[model samples]
Target: MAEKIDRQEVQHVANLAKLSFDDQALSKITPQLEEIIGLFTDLQKVDTDGVEPMYSPTTEVNVMREDKGIRSNQREALLKNAPDTQDGLIKVPAIIDESEDGDK
Candidate 1:
């Protein structure tokens, strides 16, 4: 037998998600939700006694090399291109107002 989703259950979920649905919309969605639950129930009957679980469907492997300190020596060049710089680092305007309501 397929599981059923009641109107009360749908209303409770909508309340948890801060959603508001009319009676008409609720009536229309209940059967669709029931169909989805029925599909999942059908899936539970599949035979997979010897099947191995896989994280992804594809057989691709990670062939990328490990990252190294390849850009550590480019700090001088990067700082030179900056619009504004402090002692040796880039500088920008304060984004937040620290004086507002003692927020810091």
Candidate 2:
């Protein structure tokens, strides 16, 4: 026999999850949710015994190759793509005001 869960319990869970339902919607869904939970409770009765836990069913290994640094010797080619460059570095707009110009 499966353990029975209350309809109100489902509503309480929904409330905790910040979900709102009309009285009609609640009435229709509560029994269905209870039935699903009841099915899960029924499944819990089945014994696994010596079943091994699997990360995935497939025995496939990672086909992707390791990251090989194949960087180009073309520094000028890379810097040419930048919108703004200063002192051989990519220049970006200030995220925060550290100090006003001529204040320091």
Candidate 3:
């Protein structure tokens, strides 16, 4: 079993991860962290004499279809489906924050 951790150690770990935890949150998380460490400590005692390590979850076979060239829709027909067009190309509105610019 893992030893009980204090606030200082939890704060240090939070700093290492670039995270911030207030006093109430730290108090709650400390015991949960201790329990997780104890579980890992228990797992360390398991014997695996001849077990092979797994790198992936699945035994993968060819899952993708062969990439082959095919004919596609014509440009003019595609342009006709667009909501707005300019100079034979699709035209979209500017992605600006109008509210930040004092515009309602």
Best by TM-score: 3
TM-scores of the candidates are 0.43, 0.42, 0.44
lDDT of 3 by residue, 1-104 (tens): 45567788889999999999998999899888887877878866779789898878887776887798777868899999999999999999888867678754
Q: Which regions of candidate 2 deviate over 4 angstroms? A: 50-104
Each prediction's RMSD to truth: 9.5, 11.8, 10.1
Worst 10 residues of 3 by lDDT: 95-104
lDDT of 3 at 75: 88
Cα error, residue 61 of model 3, in Å, equals 10
Better of 2 and 3 by lDDT: 3
